[model samples]
Target chain A: EPEVTQTPSHQVTQMGQEVILRCVPISNHLYFYWYRQILGQKVEFLVSFYNNEISEKSEIFDDQFSVERPDGSNFTLKIRSTKLEDSAMYFCASNQGHFGEAFFGQGTRLTVV
Target chain B: AQSVTQPDIHITVSEGASLELRCNYSYGATPYLFWYVQSPGQGLQLLLKYFSGDTLVQGIKGFEAEFKRSQSSFNLRKPSVHWSDAAEYFCAVGDGGGGADGLTFGKGTHLIIQP
Candidate 1:
């Protein structure tokens, strides 16, 4: 079965440095999302992208966070300046269309020190 | 606003015993319910979903859920659970608006199976 793939299973970055997380969603998927889960916390939605633009975002998705589908297949999330609280497991998900089941990637563990 | 509530933080069941994980939701409209399972250090996997039609919906891995409109609940159940069923189960509610809206997930319930 085709699945969403994320690169750099784990990453550690300096508190003020930048970090980029990459994901390659299923080829045919039309909707993509980024979610994060702090240790021992619930999964929280950060942002959703469709048609090469942000469709919706949560309060946690502030100006420091940005998502881009640079190429047709590659979706990337960039944090301009990482904070200690940014340490979490970041998940990438994609779906065929509206109300469709979203498939999740293994996740990228981001640890900012 | 849409929200999901999973009451149980953890549950233990012997192998071959029946299992049920409770879930409740607060949504204004008819909510789209889903159940997902995650093993240790893995991504979330969709077990089942309830959009419409039958109140009782069947899903993969011998799991099932009943959507009760009156109770605003969609609880996951299994007739006889196996050791492999040990994992974290999450209940989520979606807007069903057919867009890029994300699902609101509840705090998961950890299922422990004893052999």
Candidate 2:
């Protein structure tokens, strides 16, 4: 089965430094999303992208966070300045259409020190 | 606003025993309910979903859920669970409208299978 794939299974970055998380969603998927789970916390939705633009975002998705679909296959999330609280598991997900079952990537563990 | 509530933080069941995880939601309209499972250090996997039609829906890995409109709950259940069934289960609610709005997940319940 085709699945969303995320690169850099783990990443450790310095505070105030930039970090980019990459994801390649299933080829045919139309909607993409980025979610984060803090240690011992619930999964929180950060942003959702469709048609190469952000469709919706949560309060946690502030100005520091940005998402881009640089190419047909690559979807990337960039944090301009990392903070200690940014340490969490970041998940990428996609689905054929909106409100459908989303397939999630294994996840990228981002640790900011 | 849409929200999901999973009351139990953890549940321990013996192998071959029946299992049920409670989930309640607060949504204005008909909610899209889903159950997902995640093993330690892994991504979330969809177990089942309830969109419409039958109130009772069957999903993968011998899991099932009943959507009760009156109770505003979608509870996941299994007839006989195996040791491998031990994991974290999450109940989520989504906007029925076809928007990019993502899912709202509950805190999750950790399942421990005792031998």
Question: For residues A1-113, what per-residue lDDT tens digits would candidate 1 score against the true structure?
Answer: 99999988999999999999999999999999999999888888899999999999999999999999998999999999999999999999999997688899989999999
TM-score of chain A of each: 0.99, 0.98
lDDT of 2 by residue, A1-113 (tens): 89899999999999999999999999998989999999889999999999989998999999999999997899999999999999999999998895578989989999999
Candidate lDDT values, in order: 0.93, 0.93
Stretch of 10 with least lDDT, candidate 1 chain A: A97-106
Native-referenced DockQ of model 2: 0.67
RMSD (Å) per prediction: 1.0, 1.1
In candidate 1, what are the lDDT values of residues B3-94, reduced to their tens digit?
88999999999999999999999999999889989998789899999889999999999999999999999999999999999999999888
User: Model 1: DockQ against the native?
Assistant: 0.72
Q: lDDT score of model 1?
A: 0.93
| Candidate 1: regions farther than 4 A off | none
- For candidate 1, the clash count comes to 0
**DockQ of each model against the real complex?**
0.72, 0.67
Query: How would the docking of model 2 be graded?
Result: medium
